[model samples]
Target: MLRRNVRLRREYLYRKSLEGKERLLYEKKRKIRQALEEGKPIPTELRNEEKALRSEIDLEDDQTAVPKSSIDDEYANASERDPKILLSTSRNPSSRLTQFVKELKFVFPNAQRINRGGQVISEIVEACRSHEFTDIVMVHEHRGEPDGLIVCHLPFGPTAYFGLHNVVTRHDIKDKKAVGTMSEAYPHLILHNFSTKLGERTSNILKYLFPVPKPDSKRIITFANQSDYISFRHHVYEKPGGPKSIELKEVGPRFELRLYQIKLGTLDQTEVQNEWVIRPYMNTTKKQKILGA
Candidate 1:
C-alpha cells in the first residue's frame, strides 16, 4: 500500500508538472496575441532585444556554480558567546548550513543554535499552548522558491517565551492542521523565483537564469487551471493576520507563500536552503547577559 501510494503521488506530481508547463506556454502565447491585437507593432529592434534577453536567460540556466564562503574564518570570527538563533534543518546538517551558523555566530557574537528535529511536535505544541512564547521574530534568507521553511511560529498573545525548535515530523505535511488555538499550517513561507534581491544577483551572475516576477499585487488566483477536467481551487492569504477575511490581488501561477512573506518575494535559493532567522519579540530595557555577548 505504501508503494502504491508513493507511485500515485509520483504520477500526480508528473501530471501537475506537465499541466503547469502547458499553462505557462499558453499564457505566453496569450500575452503575445494580446500585444498584437493592441496594434503594437513587433519591431525588428524589439525582436532583436527579445532575442538577446532569451540568450541571456538560456545562459543562466546552463551555468551551475557552487557559492563560496570563507569556512576557515567561521570559527575565528564567532566565539561561543552569542545569543542563539533557532531554525529548522534536516537531521543531517549540510556543510553550507554549518557555515551559516559559523557566520551568524561571528556577526551576532552570542549565537545559540537549535536544530529542527530536536523536539517532538506534541511537546512543542504543548509549550505553545502554555505562555511559553509571546513574540516570535523570524529573520530568514529570502530564497526565490515556492516552498520556503519557517524558523519561528509564536503563540497568540504574550508570555510564551520558550524557543522550542528542532521540531520533528514523521511525514510530510502540506495541509493545515489545528494546533492549539492556532493552526500549524505547512509551508509557512513562500517566495517567487525572481522576486529576491539575491535572485537579481543570481540572474546577473548566471546568464541563463529565468527569474519569475513578484506579483505586482498580493492576491491568490483560484480556478486558474483545469486539467483532466479536474479543477483545483484554494485561497492564498496575507499572513500575520492569520486566516482572517482578507482579500489580495491575483498573481502568476508560480507564486507560493512562505511563512509571513510570499516565498520568492522574501527568500532566495542559495546553496543553504534551510537557513533561517529567529528571535523573541520583547521590549526589555534590561539587557539579558548573553553567554558570549
Candidate 2:
C-alpha cells in the first residue's frame, strides 16, 4: 500500500507539473485552427509549429478539443459520492469551543465530531484517511473563543486555513424565537461575489464540502464575499401563504472567514509548498480585494 501510494503521488505531481506546457500546446492549436477558419495567416509566434498543431487539431475529437487541468484531477470523483467530514477541535478545547464544534456538526451533513484528547494532528489525519473521510476540519480557539479553522482534503490535499471572526454560536443567540431549528436536510448553496480566479479557487474549496442538494431542499447556506471576507449564513425558507409570500429564517451560528493560507499538502505535512498566503504587510494599494473582483 505504501509503495502504491508513493507511486501514485509521483504520477500526480508529474501530471500537475506538465499543465503549463499542455496549456501552451492547446493555445497553439487553437490559434492555428482559428487562422485557418478565418483564412488569415497564422500568428508569427506560432508559425514554426503550425504544421504540427494543425495535424493535432485534425485528429482532435470533442473530448480532446479542450485540455484538461490539474484542478480537475483533484476532485475528479467528487460528485460520485457524498462528502464525509471529520470534525475536531484543538487539544483541550474550552467549553465554548466545544459548543461551537457541536453546532458545526449539524451545519455540515454527514459530519462526525470526535474528541481530540491526546491525539496529534498526524494521527487524526491518518484515522480519517483510513475511514475514507472526504475532509477533515479542525477548529482552534484563542482564550476560549474559536478563532481559526483548517480544512484539509483527504488522501491528497490543498488545505485551506481561515481566520474565524465574530463567531456567534447557536446558544449565544439572544432571541431564541427567531432562531430556526437545525434541519438535517441537504442545504442548497449560494456562492456570491466570487468573481476572480483566486476567488473561484476559494469558492471551490468551500463548495465541495457539501453534497449536491435536491431541488426541493428549502435549507440554504450562503457564502458571500465582501472585501475578501467571506460571511457564512445559514437559513431555511418557507412559503407561509403561497409561492408569492415567502418567509426566511436565519439559523444560528453565523461567522466570517478570512482566508490566510492554502497549503498544497495536508495538515501533517510540513515541507510541502504553500499554494497561497496572505501578506498583510506588503506595500500595495489600500483598496485591494484578494477574494473578489
Candidate 3:
C-alpha cells in the first residue's frame, strides 16, 4: 500500500507538469498570432521560441490560424478595390504642407486630410486600415518646399517615400490644359525605375493606385532617371510596333520623384518613417548611404 501511494503521487505530479508545459505553449502561439494580425514586427525572442515550439508540438497546427511569418508577409499586398487616399503629416501644419494638402484635395478629389495628432506611424497605419483608406500620401516639409512625399497602400503595402524635386502646378505651367488632360485621362502613369527590372516592379506599385489608361489614350507624363538631370522628354509615344515615334511637344506637368526609400516594395512606410528624416545639412554626399529613409 505504501509503495502504491508513492507511485500514484509521482504520476499526479508528472501529469501536472505536462499540463503546465502545454499551457505555456498555448500562450506563445496566441501571442504570435496576435502580433502577426496587428502587423507588429515579431520580437526576436518570440521568433526564437517559435522555432522551438515547432519541434515540441507534433499535432497539426490549428486549421483556422496560419503561420506567424505568413500572416506578417501578407501586408505586402494592396487588397483594397479603389484607391481612397488619405493625406497626412508628421509635424504640426507648416503652412506649406497645409496648403499642399488643400490643393491635393482639388487635384485628387477624394483625397482627404488627416491630422497627425501626435500619433506615430504604426498607429496611423492601423487607423488608415480601420477607416478603409486604401492609400496614404504623407508630406514631409522643410524650408519652403514640400520636399518629401510618402505613399503607403493599406492593409498590406508597397509604401514609397520620395524626395520631391521641381514641383509645379497648373497655374505655374504654360499649358494648363496639358496637365489637366493627364488627370482627365483617369489613371495615367509615368514611372521610371532608372533601369528596366526595377521599373517593372515600381510600375506595378504605381499601377495599383493609378491604373494604366484604360485601353490607352493621348495623355502625357514625364519621368526621369537618377543620373539624368539635364532634360525630361515629355510626350506620348507609339506602341512598340507601330511607327515607333513620339509626339515631342516638350510640355507637361512638371515634377520629379527620386526614390529615397526602396523598401516600399514590401514594408509599411508609416511604420518605417519613424526612424528616418530628411537631413538638409547632409545633402547628397553621406546621404547616399542611408541608415533608414
The number of the candidate with the highest TM-score is 2
lDDT to native, each model: 0.30, 0.88, 0.55
- lDDT (Cα) of model 2: 0.88
What tens-digit string does per-residue lDDT give for candidate 3 at 95-168? 65676666555444257787887888767666677677777788787776777777776554556667767766
Candidate of highest lDDT:
2
Q: How displaced is residue 186 in candidate 2, in Å?
A: 0.3
- Report the C-alpha lDDT of model 1 over 257-281, residue by residue, as the tens digit: 2122211111111222222222243
TM-score ranking of the models: 2, 3, 1
Model 2 deviation from the true structure expressed as Cα RMSD, one decimal place: 2.2
lDDT of 1 at 203: 21
User: What are the runs in model 3 whose C-alpha is more than 4 Å off?
Assistant: 1-80, 106-110, 117-119, 175-185, 192-196, 216-222, 226-253, 264-293
TM-score of 1: 0.20
CA RMSD per model (angstroms): 21.7, 2.2, 15.4
Q: Clashes in model 2: which pairs?
A: none
lDDT of 2 by residue, 190-269 (tens): 99999988899899889989999999999999999998889998888899999999998788789999998999888999
Model 1: residues with Cα > 4 Å off, grouped in runs: 1-85, 105-111, 125-149, 157-293
Better of 1 and 3 by TM-score: 3
TM per candidate comes to 0.20, 0.91, 0.50
